[model samples]
Target: MTELPAGLHEFLSKAGWEGAEIDPIPGDASFRRYFRVRRPSGERAMLMHAPPPHEDPAPFLLVAQWLSNHGLRAPEILAQNPREGWVLTEDFGNDRMRDWLDENPDGEESAYAGAIDALVELHRQEPGPFSPYDMPTYLRETSLLTEWYAPAVGLDVDVSGYDAAWSEALEPMLARQKPGVTVLRDYHAENIMLLGDPRMGAPQGLIDFQDALVGHPAYDLVSLLQDARRDVSEDLERAMLSRYAGRAGANEHFEADYARLGAQRNAKIVGIFTRLYKRDGKPRYLDMIPRVWAAMERDLAHPALGPVADWFARNIPDDLRKSGGGTIK
Candidate 1:
């Protein structure tokens, strides 16, 4: 490996981690990297390797502390460098919900129930600061979609139609959701660990939650139920949405808003996946376009989103329909 930071090796060595046993671990999304360190006591810990100036570990640490205080399982900060942005945290073990389901595809329903339960309990927790989830999600995520309609796609949406239509469609629908709860913006398959509890049974461990927001209860429902990588099936998705609504005491209008938000969210994702391929050289995201489109199409059919439905019906390039979600060009 290339030379590490000034005191990294020495600090771990002093912390009782030996010279011979550091291993690189595959990381989830984001700019930071991860490594596993073993102590002389045979205890294992995770070292967050982030380049100093770009990635900020403060929000993550603060959020972790806040969630832990609210009674969820969050990583304990064992060691940290506020300046260089390195931290050592407790390893909660390797069995994440997605990995387990992939190993046993037939077990998706039961395993995902655990994942759903984690979300239920998390939503039950009281509020805290730095809502990682709200309006920024609109500007940050929806803007990604606009990039795809650039000249590169040979479709000059160089117009503001998408922006105005999106705002008109989503804001009122978002307002309808039973607001005031912690919504994890990306709480899908990979971020949750199915930690089977001894007393409670099938509890889940959460991670990658630095993007929590204080917004609609339907937001997390859309995040989990309408995952881009795989279909959750209509029946199961319905059952899960009902479960979340029941726990949150949401009304019929809440269910309607969920459908509306799901459509809006999937549309944004379709734009994002296209941008990833054209701008970032990540072609695999394109494979998900069809699935995301399918979800959005389903949402467009919902009666509550009538205005957007009308807009999409008229505006979505005709060629895209025949090509089964290919680019407008």
Candidate 2:
């Protein structure tokens, strides 16, 4: 095994884990890294290494406490050194929703329902200390499409016109939303954990929520139903939407807001995925673009997205619409 970083090793030793076995865990797209540590007593804990100057652990700590305070299931912080960006947290094991679904496809419905149930519980809580997902944030996020993806595909879009069009399309949609709630910006399959049994009332384990925001209640729901990585079936998506609407007493404009936010989110993701390939040198994300575009297309079909649809018609070309390696060039 590779020697741990000096600071990390000292931190662990000082924390009474002097002889624990440190096993590196696979990471995702972010700069964060994780390790599984087995103590002498055979107890396990997760070590999160968010290298400073690139990533910070403060938000994760804050959100975890906030979630726990609200009776939600975020990792318990066993030990932390915020300045060093090291946090030893509760390990939820390997039963991620995606892996579970792969092993038991039939359980998709119940798993999604449990996820929705969690979201319902979260939205019911008071808002967190994050910025509202308002007009400026929306426009800034959508600009990723024009700023990154457009250039990647060799489309030189007029920035001023693009911004104007998006502002016009999204302003009214923002006005239609009810007061904002706590929005887990990346609430999807891969980040959800099935800890213990749901029948016993153990809430689904949540992670990667440092980007949580005070946004429309529909935003997280859209993220869950219209996942960029996995294909959530239309029937399941509809059922969950109805379930949330019934439970939350969502207003008449909820459906429109959901589609509006869905389109906005997918647009941001398309640009992000393209940027990941061109700038970050990660080509695997390119494979997910087709699915993101399909989700975008579905959201654009809503009447509220007419202006955004027109903007896309004027910007993105026909040949670039499909999936596979051929679509991105």
Compare the candidates by lDDT and give the number of the best one: 2
What would the TM-scores of all predictions be? 0.87, 0.95
User: In candidate 2, which residue ranges exceed 4 Å CA deviation?
Assistant: 1-3, 176-178, 197-202, 322-326
The TM-score of candidate 2 is 0.95
TM-score of 1: 0.87
RMSD of each candidate relative to the true structure: 3.0, 1.9
Candidate 1 segments exceeding 4 Å error: 1-7, 14-20, 132-140, 149-152, 174-179, 197-200, 322-324, 327-329
Q: Could you tally the backbone clashes for each prediction?
A: 3, 0
lDDT of candidate 2 over 1-329, digit per residue (tens): 35565587887887777788999987658888888999989999889888789999998999899999997899998999989889999999988888888887877888888898888898888888877888888889999988888877778877787778778767876665446688889999999998955444445899899988888888998889999889998899999999888777888888888888899999899988888888888889988888888888889889888888887777666667644213455
lDDT of 1 by residue, 83-201 (tens): 66777888867877667777767777776666666677777876567553445566456656556643445654533666666666667655553346777678887777766632245
